[model samples]
Target chain A: MRKYLLPFLFLFLFVFESIFVQYLPTEMFGSDRITVPRFLIISILFLTVFSSRKYGIIYGIIFGLLFDIVYTGVIGIYLFSFPIFAYLMSKLMRILQTNIVMVSLASLLLIVLLEIGVYEINVVINQTDLSFADFASLRLLPTVVLNSAFIIIASYPLKRHFEKFMASVSD
Target chain B: MPQFFLNKRLIILLVSIIVLVALIGFSLREREKVTWPEQFLKDMTGFVQNALSGPTNYIAGFIENVQDLQNTYSENQELKPRLDKLASLEAEVQRLKKDNAELRDIVGKEDALSQYEPIQATVIGRNPDRYHENLIINRGENDGIQADMAVITANGLIGKVKNAQSFTSTVQLLSSMDPTNRISAAIQAEDNKKVFGLIEGYDKDKKLLMMTKIPYDAEVKEGQNVISSGLGGVFPEGLIIGKVVEVENAEYGLTQTAYLETGADLYDINHVMVAKITSMSAEIQEELQSTLEEEEEEE
Candidate 1:
């Protein structure tokens, strides 16, 4: 029962987003930066922290695909990406345990790479033109800050929640 | 020796299986409708995100408020001299408003123009993976939103609705790199020249838009405007697409590529107009005209 509860938390969050939050555009202090569906990042982080690498891989794919359906982005953008991100985050978390700073940096790196990878795909697919100005400020820096901040705040809860859930599962 | 020979054959069989799998993957991609099941762990992602969103907003908002305060304080110090300039600017703005109203009155006669119907949506979800992936909108079938609906802000186009539910829909942004996003557009100022091109997104800081297939002879001076051609019926004509930023005459071909500086801040979208398309198709036109001509002849 508890096993279902942990993952259900994530499912509830996603469905809630589909129903309520998807409409509320992310307005930060009145500035609209490049706000993609942010829940993916938080979920990946949360699932990776709470569950094992295998579960992360499973949930990551599920989460990413749901995001693609929800957003209708490159239909497979998250579907293709989330499992990889989940698998990676899970592996990295296993070894890089106990340091918030390293975790923060990892989160920042993950955010930056996610943006960069998307841009790379866009260019390769000729979906849009490539501009240097956006590469610098609009696309990269803003998401980096946003993703990093999210990971920082959630890091504690993610760790605590996952730990409690894992312990409950074992018992 | 027989055992060694058998091991070699087994290794070769394994290699062949790997190669076959790879070849099938490559060939299958062109028609792959790969989708949702792969990424979505469960719907619960939203609840977790909802939990995380609070404090994240708080901290990010705090930083921005501080930044805005600094900017406002600095502006306050420079307010006196700018006050006179601002008065002149206000007068200029009023003059422009009158001119705009006059233009609007004239253009209002052209009822064929695309009418903007607006629906307000929250930016509840961002692209889960990448910054430019796409946006999920809460307004869906219940709001009368259908697939291919043009989503826009008070400023400009965001993208079109792809998949919709009773309560929500997914928007594929103009920034999405899908090749099918080719938009037919017209130059804002020239009015006579139309550019059939695709708006491809790029790796720029401000979500830059680039247009290809500007007639080699088109007068695409920098700062000239770009607007949709209303060709595909996805967007209305005359909505400000962007301003021409860079016009290129590369030696390889007799085509011009223009960079349009997009209008709306793609980062912050609130209320967007879903243009209800009301254009007559050529087939419909032909049928109606032929019937009218027959009626007149009988008379």
Candidate 2:
């Protein structure tokens, strides 16, 4: 029961933020469309801390594929970017096991880089005029701040659960 | 853990990626033609989406009906005494008439225009996320819509039919913020000189209808009319693009900013027109010439 609690709760919260929280106080922040939100990056980071390395990568890939299918995009964007994030987090695992701050910083760096890479490739190669204005300031800064905070605050309980899981499996 | 499961997952992933790539390449190859399987998928998706949207549509329709009934009920009560007078007013239809030939010509033009074959559709779904402006209409391959079919209305242009499945089609509206929406049109005036422009959507702040490449010498006024250039093979000449409300020249030179406003109210539109262009002779030649010039300039 406790093991499923974190994934379950985070899933609900992410969905709520994805669907609803982004629309509040419509007078100021409302717009026509949003690019892929950075919540996905934060989700991947949390899962890396709690789940197995292989499991984390698999989940990210599956999530990316789902994102591609549900949204009208180039179909392989999330598919490509997500696996890279998974691999990086897995590599980072050895160096930073107990530190929440390191995970937050790493995830934020990857997300910002990922946005620039995707936007540039689409604009240059495909000639898709996806606007990068929202991405640079209001969207990126707020997303990094909010997501890093969530990941840092949520890491302790997740770390404990993973330790217990490792113990049970080893025994 | 054994490696068998990992091997299986790898195989599945590789196969899926291959399939996705193949489909993309396939679509790119035949960008102009409508495939049968894609048509079927569109129809089936529309059927499912329409089934899902039935309840919401019913509620909205029901609310509208109640309001209409309330208005009619009061109007009927008030008009009871005037009904006898109105009946006499209608009798002049046969007696008091103008030039018969002129009236017939007036009626004949729109009658021919309205003779277009159309499949009625309901918008079953929109892009679930707030990121893209796309709508899925319930009419698809089964409804006779093919890829590139013009989706329009009695008044003006709405969009084009992109992917038509069996019973549903994904309509790419003219006002879509996507940069690909380069509508070919001309200014409707004495000159009717050739013109082209791009239409982009904004949910707020004067949903824009932006035109490009109009020469500075072109005598364009703020209230001057814009129409489909007919130079493009896709749209017929003189479909009302919009009334040009403003124009400005930039320091960059050569091209003036033609701030156009479209006639189509996408937010209120419930129906559209899709024209299947048959003869591509004159229009195609003109399109080819203009496009070549534009490409050369880019080069």
Candidate 3:
């Protein structure tokens, strides 16, 4: 039962982010489109922090492919970006003492990198028409704010879960 | 020492990049149908989306209903005059319909949209990518949904299906700025002149559809209603798209561009009706006219 918790949580986050976040009132955003939730990726980053970095890379690939197959028109954008960001975050964590503040800052920095990475790839393929300035002000800023709020709220509980999982694995 | 110089991690990185490029190249072909693996995953996720959306939507609806009750009295007062006007217009519309039918019979014309069949579906999910405008709905190929069928709510046209799986479909909203999704639209002038244009793309940030190719001399204005002209045979005739909110001169042409505010609330859609045209437009129109002429000759 314990073995299933992480994957189940990731799946639950995916479904909720896709379906429930849209229910948020547009008035809150002052526009129709809301920021895309990065909760699933954020949860994977948590795994990298507490349980194991390897698990983060593995889950990122599996779930990222599922996201690509289900939602995106193309197949490889999220598939590669997710695991790369996860690995990068875990590597950065090694230099700094891991705490809610440090992890939150690292996650924010990594997410920004991921956004820019996706945008550059999209531009190369001529899939996006948005200018960099507009993309930054409109999408990246709000997304970072929303995901930061999520990290602040979930950090402690997720940290505890990851530590437990790590301890069990060692035993 | 020489073997140790070649890192396993570097090789893995190189291999993943190649795999990534290959996957992108493969998926860029624009296939008519999703492959089996994609179909299977979409179906499974669709099931989960539907299962979870049901109870949550119910709870959300309940909250909205409670809020609506608070506004009911004022809303009723505001709607009373419109309700009276609507009743009178409904009767007038019925009379006009009968008159139009008689005129059509004499002229050997058929209903402009008789080829369409509409299927109702519930919206289950939105595109996880904020930049793209796609909605996932509960109906798919199993319910006879096909690519390019127009999806509309009670108010007006919202989008068309881009992909149809066995149990779910993806609707590319009119707000999608893809160059390939142009819709043939026309403005019904107050003087009864029909001016045509193409809804070419959308401005996502501004939440407006960009229509082009209107003749410069055409009498276009803000607040004019735009509807599908059905010139392309892809969209059926007279589907309400939106109302013109602005008109501007073309960047470098003899044409004009009109920006339309879509009537359908793209932010808060729940249910939609997908319209499938059963017959080819030109063939159906010709058949109807020929039969009507034959009957008249017999008379």
Candidate 4:
């Protein structure tokens, strides 16, 4: 039962991403910036840093596929990006010191990469016509701020949870 | 480091990238319906979304109610005068409806393009990614919803059903930048005339609907109402779409374009109605089908 906690947590975040994020008032941001919740991806990054990279990539693939099928009509965007980013993060973790600040910064970088990749694909497929400058200012900046804030607040708690869970599983 | 080209991980990455490209291309085609596996996954996610959103919406509604209380007095003061006018307006509408029905009876015509049945639905989830403005509703194929059905609110047209699963459906909002998302619309002109055009795209900067292909000589004013023309055969006629806010000529000077402010607020939506156009009669439908086939044969 305890071994299932991490997957259940990721499931909750996945569901909350589609269901509750829209309720946050756009008027608070004054309508210029669009703040997207990448909570699932952010937490998966933390899982890679604090727990096992293998488990993190596995969860990333599972939840990424779910995100693709449930939210977007396109399938391969998240399905490919999420696990790729997790693997990249795991490699970066080997070089950098493990701490809250580094984890948050690394998560922010991964998110920027993911957003730009998705945006470029959208441009090629003619799904959007937003200029590169406008995309950087309007969507990319605010999304980074929002996700970084989430990572800052959630870093310690998630770190502790994953450590405890890994202990119990290994036992 | 190991030889880069010979690494097993590199080979796996190359294979997956090829697979990803294939999947994206396959899904990008114009599909009539999703496969059963995709439908099953959508239903499963939609079920959980529905369950979770109910309580969240209740809590959000409570917060909104509290906020509304602060404006209640001023809102009531403004609405009091409108209340008196509403009664007379209601009477006028009733009289006009009766007259129109009598006229239709005299003409021996019972079927109208505006005839439709409304299916009420609750919004269960919205796509987190803001690029594609899509809403998942609690109603689906089980509720007689089909792809391309017009989804509207009491205010006016919002979007159309993109996909219908077993117990849930996805609605693509008008603001999405899909090139194929075109609607046949008409601008209400002077003396009860209508200037027909295609609502071809959306201007993201201005947050307005772009109506194009109007004749250069057509007179479209800033305040004119835009409604679906039903020429597209998907949306019902006379469904209010928006009000024109600006007009300009095309670059080639052969056609005009207008920007319209949508009647329904695309961002904040909770409940909607799917307009199911009622086919006239079996005999008429068969006759129409036969005529269409004959026209195709001539072509």
Candidate 1: list runs displaced more than 4 Å.
A1-5, A8-58, A72-152, B1-120, B190-207, B250-253, B281-299
Assess the local accuracy of residue B123 in candidate 3 as a C-alpha lDDT between 0 and 100.
85
Candidate 3: which stretches are off by over 4 Å? A25-29, A32-34, A168-171, B1-5, B102-111, B278-282, B285-299
DockQ score of each predicted structure, in the order shown: 0.18, 0.09, 0.60, 0.72
Which 10-residue span in candidate 3 chain A carries the lowest summed lDDT?
A: A25-34
Identify the leading candidate in terms of lDDT.
4
- The best candidate by DockQ is 4
Query: What TM-score goes with each of the models?
Result: 0.61, 0.57, 0.91, 0.95
Per-residue lDDT of candidate 3, residues A1-171 (tens digit) = 456686778888888887755587343456743476888888888888778889999999998998887777689999998898889988999998888889888888888888888888887777778889888887788788888989989988988888887877777
Listing every candidate in turn, what is its Cα RMSD in Å to the true structure after a full C-alpha superposition?
A: 9.0, 9.1, 5.3, 2.1
Model 3 residue B27 CA deviation in Å: 2.4
Off by over 4 Å in 4: A25-30, B1-5, B279-299
Candidate 3 lDDT over B153-191, as tens digits, reads: 989999999999999999998887677888989998888
- Model 2 bad stretches (over 4 Å): A1-70, A89-114, A129-134, A138-171, B1-30, B33-133, B152-158, B175-181, B190-207, B213-217, B229-233, B236-240, B249-257, B264-299
Candidate 4's residue-wise lDDT over B138-196, tens digit each? Answer: 99999999999999999899999999999999999998878889999999999999999
Interface C-alpha RMSD after superposing true interface residues, each candidate, one decimal: 7.5, 6.5, 2.0, 1.6
What lDDT does candidate 4 reach at residue A117? 92
Model 1 chain B: ten consecutive residues of lowest lDDT: B33-42
